[model samples]
Target: MDAEIGYLTPGRTRRRSIARTIFAGSIGNTVEWFDWTIYTVFAIYFSNQFFPSQDTTVALLATFSVFAIGFFMRPLGGWLIGTFSDRHGRRSALTLSILLMAVPSLVIALLPTYSQIGVFAPILLVLARMTQGLSVGGEYGAATTFLTESAPAKRRGFYGSFLFLSIALGLLIASGIAWVLTNNLNRTQMELFGWRIPFLIGGLASLIGLWLRRNVDETQAYKDMANKGEIPKRSLRWIWRHHRPAVLRLIGTSVLPAFSFYLFVSYLPIYAIQRGGATPEVAFRASTVSIAIFMCALPFFGRFSDRFGRKPQLIAFACAYLFFLYPVVNSVGSGFWSVLLVECFGLLAYGLYASIAPAMMAELFNTEVRAVGIGAFYNVVIALLGGTTPYLMAWLQSINLESWFLVYVCAGAAISLYSFIEMPETRGKTLD
Candidate 1:
């Protein structure tokens, strides 16, 4: 571990360099999440274009089903890209992930509607989403590994928080675009063409992300591992044989965070409109404000973890979710201010987990298997739980059982709370 730490220079110059590197590393993540998120944000407008149904609910269910289908591809993405990141380098993996995301976004932007393409439209949409899912699965592992590895030892949590910060930025941008489009265009215009604009923007933005990631330095940890010939030949097999406990712990720790993230950040606005009786503009506006608050709070929470410990922050998040998620969900239709307040409150608590997740997860393994360890199991769990969140919520609402989804989220929180309790504190630890 000391040898690994030796690879990173500690100085003012290095500190200055770290900021640029973190931004460069995180920009691709922003684009990756932006591409991934716009699908959900615009689903209401575009659901009819691909899945024509007399019942809007059925069309949305179909749309969210495609969303869930895309998630099923995440594990495969995690495995393939995680292994690639382990073998090649984080920079290569990051670049590859962005390229994968860009093409799919462009494809979705350009594809014809069902009216023009018949049954092929939805099929094409599904294929595009699956490819983007793969990109995101890879993006999380690689970006987490890169950002955590690149930070100064004592400041890993503070730097690592940028991972989710970028995600929030992506969500903000997606929601902001959705708000602008919805406010500017009529229903027909949004359904016909406005929904495609975000995808086009995301696709073009990927070029900037690509160029940024391409120029950033590869992490010192990866460099040290390469110099020492520590790169694993088969990351997944090695992880199962040697580090099974760590991977399981990671999955457990992630359960609530993943579920809560989609529930609050991605699906909440939709819930407001469909279940809670809010308008699209109200939901989007509220969502945007809440997300901004969430994004702003991340760095402070992350820096706090650096001072305190990872476990306390994570435990706080789980307990907050377990106790408060029901009321938060119940507040969905209450009014604009109530919705905004709950969204901010819930996401602020969630910031406790989001801010330190990358560093904590990175501390679970050595550099060789770090990316893959997180990629393989983490992506699978997210696929099963996180990816299905919006679909499950929609399904529950359809049956007048939306409350059950709250129970489901709390159950996940309980599991995560237990996991956080059992896990050791990893603050100020050296990367191996």
Candidate 2:
């Protein structure tokens, strides 16, 4: 193998540069998730501010409907920006996507409330969400692909795992900020203005991410593709013709990670508040600690996968699915420490899947369709499974069938695990 061009190398200097690339890529993920989750964490307070209907559930539903709209735009964003990433360069695509996210997140942070502008408030909220959805839709696949492609082969799992460690950190940042702000304010102060603080904070984090991203180089794979004049004339078209199996496989494999990630990271706060009958402070604390524990372990699991192979890690995770998923979710409201323990356990098990799946899945497709094929399909599942998990859980809980939510997630995980068996083991394989 060519020492410099191959995924693995024995060079100390190259390892450090790979570290820098992963760090830069991880920041955008952090900022994107933080920007996204801040909206969810603060939804209870801000939903009424932007959308006031006679029934509170209806108003909250409308607010989350805007959230779902963001999800709807994600597939389109994934297809568009992902094609750009394939044709252009990964670093540039990532930088551009973060900027797209920053603008609307800042706008949402500072926008006027429904009380101030009537129906326009919700309209503007929907517009901002659409922008956010578009940004994230593009951000995930581009950023993760860059990080994975740039990392040293032996440590690809370790480095790639940071993508979600940073994501977990991002959620911790949102929940921590929301917890402090909500705790600081009198009820009126929080309702009036304090709720905006998290978005403001997200804008600042995004700006930092933008700055760091500026320093990273394009991936070698992309540079080679570009130099050969092999950038697909039609990235999307090539995806359908050549990579349909890879895409469908990703969609099924996506179900577990998407469901687990959203349930643990996105919806947990709401569940804690609404279903678990906990205060914001308690829920935020639980999420922070639980996710932090998981983040710490991400690199280890990822590095382990690099040695053991992708399929084995996913299979192992699947085998243990029954023991972890439902037990933890059902137990989250049991109390602070117990809920924390259970949620952290779930995240820990999820690490086996989330830590290595990005690189594993991306490697399955050819470079021509790599971007749109991976991004569009991967995000589409998230838009469905991840975006709707909470809403569906809420509905189930409303009907006194809350435990069934666990079964749904478990079933999804099982489907994903089954799909994993059919995937080729891509431990040290070359990416075309």
True lDDT of residue 46, candidate 1: 92
lDDT of 2 by residue, 71-118 (tens): 889988888888888878888889889998898889988899888888
TM-score of each: 0.90, 0.90
Full-model lDDT for every candidate: 0.87, 0.80
Q: Which segments of candidate 1 are over 4 A away from where they belong?
A: 1-16, 48-60, 114-120, 266-281, 327-333
Q: Write one digit per residue (lDDT tens) for candidate 1, span 1-432.
A: 886567654665677687788897789888888888899878999998899999999999899888877788889888889899989999999999999999999999999999998999999999999898889888989999999998877899999999999988987787778768888999999888899999999999998889888988898889999998656587577688899889889989989987877777667877788778988778877878888988999989999999999999999899988998898778667489967987887889889999999999999988888888888889989888877776687688888897898899899999999999999999989998
Task: Output candidate 2 Cα RMSD.
Answer: 4.3
